[model samples]
Target: MKDKLARNISIYRKEQGLTQEELAKLLGISFQAVSKWENAQTMPDITLLPALSTILEVSVDKLLGYVAQDKRITIYEDEYQTEDYYWGTEPNTACYQVLQLIPPTKPLKLLDIGCGEGKDAVFFARNGYEVDAFDVTNAGIEKTRRLADRTGVHVNVFKADLLEFRLDTHYDIIFSSGVLHYMKPEYRADIFDNYKRFTNENGMHVFNVFVNKPFIAPPPEKETNAYPWQSGQLLTYYHDWLIRDSAEIVFDCNSSGIPHQHAMTTMVAQKITTSP
Candidate 1:
């Protein structure tokens, strides 16, 4: 456990481009103390874990190296077999809004993370963008491929888990509609960092997440499928980017014909720098 924590701390600190002295200054500790922690010679005081995690842009669980036993791949496989458009067939409204905000240029290269049925990916491909879409389940990928064929549009659809997927190419537009929030909280920072890293300069990212709300009841205790963001939490991850559009709204959940109110945070931001 100590080794894992030390390794994670070192990796995250370097990812943020902070030296021991710099991280120590942020933590109000001495450089030697930071070095010791990274060296596995000592641990940070328990009380400092929260502040340390906040500065490193990770959750405390991640700092301590908690691994999520994710069941999304299996759950999604079952869901896709029963409902083709479990989330909906129409592209999200935010996707259209983001298209309008894109600068006038040649057709862009786009990637859709967690693209279930390829509706949005096909929509973009039909409009002339080179699109690549991925989902974790084979059923989802199969559905997306069929949708692309039915629409007479070409889309590269594959099954890949977001946590382990690597990008061979950068994209001018990265769209993830309602998918990211399903990640475990401890893993979100790394996922967001990857999004920024694989986005081309001046490219845009459009996504949405469920946010914690007093009015919305929590999912069942045994359900680990969704992780809701704290209010205003999503924007904090994009501090180095230029926010083009954002909204917090409460809406009806019509995707599965399930009638329920959901509080969500939607954002469209442009990459201004290579790092965030």
Candidate 2:
């Protein structure tokens, strides 16, 4: 692990165009310490791993040279080729509730991850927020761009896979609807941590995930693209943040033209300060 960390630290630092002294200054440590870590003469404290990984734009697991097995991109691309809005055309109810909490007088920067058809992205742009939205498929991104143009709202749309997506700018509000649940368990927490890092102080994050419930069964055997979260797991990730709202509800979904019941965990949290 130490050897791997050393190799990754040197590799990532160079990849970011940061010198040893620059990296040490960012970490608030001495250059000697940075040199030692890369030389495998010493290791960073466990508590510093999160900050180190964040600075390097990677997960701690990746910093430790562990790779995540992600296989959802093909599934999403195939789905997008056949359907325009797999979720729906309208913004989810959670999005409306989150908008009400934002200050009406302020024009904040917003990011809509997994923004399909740009419904929520268009809604935010039309309401005076600067919006950037992205999805895994070109089809979804194209639809988002077209919707924004038709609505006379300005929204930047791009194609990105969430598993490999990196934030280039911090946002005041990051909205992701019905997206994180598809992630593998090991990758979900790291993604949320990254979201927190890319959110400015006092910024709010609003998202929803499928959670386990007696009444809501798993997807059919033929469905290989679903991952359900355990009840209350989402809230645990926001222990250091101010939880504005949280709820577990059963809802009906007809995104695929077949009606089904879904149990979901919805949450809105504000980052008041850096995590300890």
Candidate 3:
């Protein structure tokens, strides 16, 4: 919470065009105090929260790393509202790899990051893995629940923004598909670290990211938040982990009814703990 508050203070303060000195002046404190708060060295007094939040134009909950609620946050929010599944209900081919690599001989916990419409989550749940899934869109969450209900499976689903959500619980597997690109490059390191830290020993992370290739044209849909990665960039973060599989592929997409090509990288990595 302290770390989140510190980061929020700095981020919001900068967004509001206020320097540390200016914020300190507004709060009737020394700039060093504001610096301390932003550096996570110390927290502000409870009494000063209101003024600070007001100045930063952010909710107190947000500053403390608690998301108030998800709104119409994604480009796909409206697309997910219809009776038909926008992305369809089929699980990605990569899901089968998960089943093969880490078959649930016993109960295993799996988390689906950005589980659009919950097809994969429900699939995992039906396959005997405990599944928890979240997406930024309310419609997506509803559709996911509907799919799970229709499939006679219970997929624990919720709504959360990828940028603000962090994992604090352990899981045997973490899976995400066609979503990591929505994460701003600046936050990838911290988010990946958080994901890696919370994974149980020998737990696997099956993830795919859209990567930039000179031959591939830009995606048809212009995303405000998309940052296509470079080749081999994702592997750098897993230097310590055993990389089970990694591949790059070029594929066609017709999401917005326009033909386009995308280069994507998929990686399956396992966290291994060695004896000292």
Candidate 4:
């Protein structure tokens, strides 16, 4: 564990172009302590694991260097491939509940960020919303376009990275599911800040994330050295935005045959208004 933690720390620190002293300062610990940890002479305490994970961009389990012996469930690769994961599944049922939250109004401008396979986008268009979806995969974009044509619904799907793409218009509802969770904690705040920028004053922002906590007794093993609260493709955290309009907890009592702990959550925040 000590050797693995040291290796992970050194690798990430090098990638970030940070020296040991710089890393120590960020962690607010002594240079000697950082050196000791990197040299395998000492280990970080458990209470400090989350902070260390945030600073190092690695998971707590990875910090301890314990690998999962069991196979993990693959969530989805991109928008198109996600169809199999949601169709006829309990997760899809939960997704329907979210879709129902959109008010029944014609020409409601909608931005489906990280729209996988255009399922939600197509659904929105069929239900009378002007849907524009964006995803990073070429395959997903083509497939979504084909689906829209076949269904006789007009959806503008773009094959581009949402992070780099600029939205030219404001939307009534800007929504994402299973997207924010995948972002590293270090970048999650920045992503939300950008969302706030793109949203209109009256627009609503809705998204899902894994809340911090483990599910069931004898918890599952970590998949990646990503973060303490999130595993591979699964992100869990509460909304940190200041102007939240509403929030809710939709527990997944039965998801994928495994008892999930703090696995399902939804939050809505509105762009705040100020006097002119």
Candidate 5:
């Protein structure tokens, strides 16, 4: 896996539109050091990780390249309620954050892969962007459609799996939230490859994935052993195909306020484009 220190510095610097000289002057490092760090010629020392994360407005875990995973350990009902109903959780917030990243409307084409119940789909549709939503589950499709109807939003919902799904066109913004991390990591390689192929050059692609956490089950834990264990789901790693903007997903299985609820990890990412 790639180290995130340099990447974090780069993202923060770009966000603030700070030049190397400016950031270096602030960090008390030479401009050459900033350039070398950004280029990955050398790394920031462990002592600097906290300062870097604070300057970047991201958590130290993210700056240190830590990714979180969801464990999906909640009881069936609470899990369903959290996944389909609550927008505060990471899985739901993942899409919401992506929506904020994109330039508003501007007649863009959008896609929501694995759009369970179309909650985010409806939100995007009502915001005046044309949207196409897809899900692998039949019930999810039906529920998405019902929700779309009730919301009086015009969103085209489809039923298909990533392996079998095809499109005759590309999208300005193609995104999948709360879906990719469920599969084993090997299964995700092809999906990332396809995502790059289907996005236009000037277009952007964004998605959320559960990240690997520090903990996992013991031996004989067949299902959970292979991946990072979060509340109850397996964690996976993902990165920018062309650029490197990444975020984390943490599923809170044992939430302080709610004992019976569980949710999936949510990590948000955006494609980076160079301005002309």
Candidate 6:
């Protein structure tokens, strides 16, 4: 809990564009005290928490690493309840890239972050990669389990909010798809750091995010929580890692029963301990 609180404070502070000194000034405390709280070396005084929460624009519960039970942030929660798979059960083409780049000839652990309906997770499990996947919606979690069971493969599926969840265990391959754009821009750096830190040496990250472009317009789905990334933004985080492949593409979509176009960036980067 302490670790999560520390991380949330750091992330939210940066999100509000406040330096430690600035936050300290606002809270009538010393910067060192703020630093200590962010470092997880000490906890903020109970009296200070409410003020901290107000300044950071987050609730006290979130600051203390708790998500409200009644809150449902995902837009797909209702769509996922339908009998037919909303996004279809076919694995994304990125799964093939994973197979090509790092064939699972040996035992490998994989995690599907923001897994919607479990198509890619089931694909990896069928191909002999130990798979675990999560989504924010309970409906999505149930569908992933149903699909995995029908496919006769095991997938450790669960529900999680991407913002509140952090990887504590190691994985050889980590994959996320269109779901990453839900994260606010300020929170991405720390989230990526956690991901890169928990990945095994020589592990790969297969990810893609919808990118904002002048030529292409937004899709029909007006999702309040979605935040499209800037072009090339995803690659910026992998500067020290080995970039096996990267590309930006424009695609047609009919997600909300309307014809539209979107620009997206895709990357397959590998973690190499030594300079590559």
- Per model, state how many residue pairs clash: 0, 0, 0, 7, 10, 0
Sort order, TM-score high to low:
6, 3, 2, 1, 4, 5
| CA lDDT for candidate 4 | 0.59
Clashes of 6: 0
Give the clashing residue pairs of candidate 6, or none: none
lDDT string, candidate 4, 1-276, tens digits? 567676567655665777889988987888888888878899877777788778767667755655321222223333245434332212233335435655655456888887756667777777677888986655566666767787789988875443334454678777777655445555454456656676766567776665554443322534352243433222122233333433445454433456644454556655556643
| Root-mean-square deviation per candidate | 8.8, 9.3, 3.1, 11.9, 16.7, 2.1
Model 5: residues with Cα > 4 Å off, grouped in runs: 1-91, 216-244, 254-275
Candidates 4 and 5: which is better by TM-score?
4
lDDT of 2 by residue, 1-276 (tens): 777688678767875789999999999999999999998999999999999989988888878767522244535556666545655567778767867898547779999998977888888888888999988767778878877888899998877666556565799999988788657665567577878899999889998888888866654324455666888899998999999999888877765566788888889999998555
TM-score of each: 0.70, 0.70, 0.87, 0.55, 0.53, 0.90
In terms of TM-score, the best-performing candidate is: 6
Q: What lDDT, from 0 to 1, does candidate 5 have?
A: 0.59
In terms of lDDT, the best-performing candidate is 6
Better of 5 and 6 by lDDT: 6
Better of 2 and 5 by lDDT: 2
Write model 5 residue lDDT over 1-276, tens digit each, in one string. 133466556655765668889888877789998888877788877787677666766677745545321233212223234335433312355456556767555787889887876788888887777899886555566767777788888889976555334455677778776565444444445455556566765666666544444463232222342344343222233344343244343344433344332233443334444655
Q: Give the lDDT of residue 47 in candidate 4.
A: 73
Tens digits of per-residue lDDT for model 1, 137-194: 7778888888788889999987766654546579999888867766766667866887
| Deviation from native of the Cα of residue 7 in model 5, angstroms | 36
Give the range of the ten consecutive residues with the poorest summed lDDT in model 1.
Answer: 67-76
User: Ranking under lDDT, best-scoring first?
Assistant: 6, 3, 2, 1, 4, 5
Best of the two (1, 6) by TM-score? 6
What lDDT does candidate 6 reach at residue 246? 95
Q: Candidate 1: misplaced stretches above 4 Å?
A: 1-74, 219-223, 274-276
